[model samples]
Target: MKLECQEKHSEIRNGEIHVYAWFFNRNVYENNTNVITFNKIKSERSGKYTCVARNKAGFDSDAVNIIVTYPPIVWTKDITFNGINRPRIIKCNVSGVPNTYNITWRHYTNNNQLVRVFNNRINGVLILPEGETNDLVFEDSGVYRCNVTNGIPDESGNLWQSKKIQVKVEGKPVLAKPLKSTFIGHFNETSSISLFVLSSSNVTQAEWKAAENRNSLGHGCCSSTVNKTSFNGKCLDMSGYTCVFLIKNTREEDFQNYTVDLINKNGRNTFDISLISSGVPEVPSITDIYQRQNYIVLEWKPTFDGGAPQGFIVQYRKKKDKNWESIRIQSNETNDFVYISKLKPDTEYELRMLAFNRLGNSSFTVQFTTLFKGETKDVWTQFNLFLCIPIVLPVCLFVFLLWYRKVLHDGIVTMTKVWLLDTISIFLVTEMTYIPR
Candidate 1:
C-alpha cells in the first residue's frame, strides 16, 4: 500500500524542503519524501496515513484513510422463540470487502438430517414463517446454520464462513409419567421428591407451593382445614427433564396439597401432590444415665419420628417435692443426651421424657439420684486410709521393737509408755480429712 502528498505552491521560499510521512501518528518515512509505502500489509496496517512537507518557512500536513478488506466473517445474535406458533427472526452479523453477500440457511435435525431453509443474496436476517397457517413446531427445533460469502476468501482460502444458531421451540411442560398424588414425608427431616418430564421444552423455572391448611391437631394425622395462608418451599433442582423439590426440616404445617409449578417461555403447568404424616412418634426410652455432684446426664436413643419431626419434653421432680419442673428440647438440640443441672445433691429424683410431634406424645418415666458432694470425697479418703494402714503398721511395729530393745539395753523401764504415746500421736496425724473434689 502506498500514500502520496502533492506539493501545491510554486514559490521557492527558504532552504530545501523536508517531507515526512506518518501512519496513525507514527513516523514511517522522513527526509525529502512525500510518499509512504507499507510492505506486506495486514488488517492492522489499515488506518489513517498523514504526509507533512516542511521548509524553513513553515509546515503543511494532510491525511487520508486506508481500508483493508477480507472475506466474510459471520456470526449470529442469540434469538429466543417464545413458543410454538410464534414467528421468530434469526439475524447474523456479516463483515467483508463487499457489503453485498449471499446468505444460505440450513438446519440439522436431531437425527442429523439436513434441510435447507433459505439461500438468497440479501441482508443477514432470516424470518421464519409466522401466523396460524405456518406456525413453528417442536420439529423445527434444531441447529440453524447461517453461511455467507462475498467472493473474497479468508487467509485459509475458504470462500464460505458460517455460524450455528440454536433454535428451540418451547411449549408447555409435559410429564413423562403422571406424578404420584400423595407422598409420605417425615417431620424435622429432609424430604426429596422428584418428577420426570418427557419434554421439558426448556423449563426455565420450577416452584413448590403449599395450599392453606390447618395444623395437624391430634394423633389422627392427615386431617386438614382450609383456614390458613399458603406458603412456598424451595425448588431444589430443575435440570433437563427432571424436577426435584425439597422440603427441608419438614414440619406439621408442611403437610398439605403442594403445587409444583413448571414454567417456560410458552407457559406454565401445575402438578398437585399431597404430603401426609406417617403416624405418632414412638415412646422415648432412656438408654443410659450418669450421676454427678448436683447434676445428672441422661442419654437416650432416638425413636421413630412418626412421619413428622419430633421433640422431647423432660419432666422431673425431687422425690419429696410436689411440683415437677419441665424442659422442652427441640429435635435438633438433642445429641443423644440431656444435661440436667442445679439439682439438689443426695436427693432422689423422678424423671420422665416424652417424644412429641404434631400428632401426639409418648413417654416413659425413669428415676435417678444425685450423689452428695462429700460422698465421693469420703470414698477417696477411705481408699487412701486402707492403703496406708498395712504399710504404716508394719513400719511402726518394727521401729517400736528396735526402740524397746535399745531401751532395755540401756536399762530403761518406760518403753511401753513411750510406745503408747508415739502410737497415739501417729494416729492423730494420720486421721482422714475430707478432701474437696
Candidate 2:
C-alpha cells in the first residue's frame, strides 16, 4: 500500500513543509512534508486512517482509508491416482484473504487448448474438494494449474500466485512382453530366463512358484534380478521393467515350468518359463562308405538318442581348414544312412556328425577322412588274376615237353643197338613196339 500527504502554505520554513499522518488512527509520520508512504503492504494493514497538515496557528485534518491487497498461496504437492480403485478424488488446499480469494483450476487438453473443468465440485454429494478433480481417468492426466487471485490491483497481474500439480493415472501390471514359454539349458551350466514387464510405477513385487507350491525354486539353485527403464516402440509407450531368473549348476530336475507372479497396487499378472536340459548324443562310428563321382554314400550304426527323439547334422570341411560347413536333416526318427554329394574331386575332407532335438544339441562325433581317387587296389581282385594267369602257363608247358622227349629218345636208341647184333632171324623172337622216326 502507498499513500501521499502534503500541506500547501504561502511560505515554507527550513525549505520543507511538515505534515503528520496516522495509520489506523495512530500517528506514523510527523516530520515529513508533501509525502507519506508505506513501502510494503500486508493483510493486517487494512483499516481506516487519517492525515493532518499543521501550521503555527492552525491545522487541517483529512480522513482517508487504507486497504492492503495480496495474492493467495496454494498448498499443493505431487498427486497420484489409482485408476482401478473406487472414488478417486484429489484435494486442493488454498489460503488467502478468506472472502476475497478466488481459486480457479484449468488444464490443457491434448490439443493444448485451455478449457475450464468442473469435476464434481459440489460438497457432500461429491467427495472431491473444491477446485479439484474426481474419478480420475487416463484422459484427465496432465499439468493442472491453480490460479489464485483476490481481484485486488497490485504490481502483479491478474494472477496472484500459481501452482502446478502433476497428476498420473496408474493401472495394474499389464504384461507387454511376457516371459518366453520355452528355455534350453546345458547340463552343469548356468542358464537364465528374462521377462519384460511394463508397470506404471518403479516398484513391483515378484514371486516364483512351481509345482503347485510357493517359493519352491529355493535360493541355492535359483536367483532373479529386476531393472526398470523406458522403452520405445515395443513397449507401447510405457516404461519397461525387466525381471530375470538364473538357474545355477543346472540339473535334470530343473527342467520344468516355472511361474513368475508380479503384483502392484494396480493389479497382478503371471507368466511361465519352461526350462529343459540337453546333453550330447553318443559318438557315431562309421561302418562303410561307397565312393561315387565326387560323392560318397555313408552308412553308420545309430548312436544313443540322448533321452529324446533325435536327428543328425553333418558337417564337413577341407582337411587343412578348421571351419566346417554343415548339412541339416529335419527328422525326429533315427537315420541309418545319409548320401553326401557335391564334394570336390581329389580334395581331402574331414567330416563329422551331431544329433539334436528341442532339448539341446549333441557334441560332434570323431572326424573321419574320405579316400582319394584310385587309392583302392587289391591283389585278389579279378582284374589282376586274369592278366597274370595267361602269361605264366605257356612258359611252364614248354619246359616240361622238352625234358620228356630227350629221355624217350635215349632209351629207344639203347634197346635197338643191342637187338640188331643178333637179329638175322630175331624179328620173330622179340616183338618190339615201333618207334616213329
Model 2 CA deviation exceeding 4 Å by range: 1-19, 24-31, 38-47, 52-61, 68-145, 148-161, 165-205, 211-215, 218-240, 244-437
- Model 2 C-alpha lDDT per residue in residues 1-437, reported as the tens digit of each score: 45666555566664543446454557464535445556767777676667776656556777677655556656777677665544545556665554456555665432344434544232212133222122232434455666666665446565656677676668655444322477666677787766666555653566667745556553222122233222111222333465667888987777888887777666666666677665556656667766865577777676765545677788878899889988877755456777777766677778788777666677777888985463345657655456544554454445544654565666754657445533622442222222222
Q: Please provide, for model 1 over 130-207, each residue's C-alpha lDDT reduced to its tens digit, 9 standing for 90 to 100.
A: 544212334355678889998888878888998988876566765432235677777798776666652325566667
Clashing pairs in 2: 172-266, 172-267
What overall lDDT goes with each candidate model?
Answer: 0.66, 0.58
- Top candidate, metric lDDT: 1
RMSD of 1: 18.8
Q: Cα deviation in Å at residue 27, candidate 1?
A: 12
All models, RMSD in angstroms: 18.8, 31.8
* Angstrom error at residue 227, model 2: 12
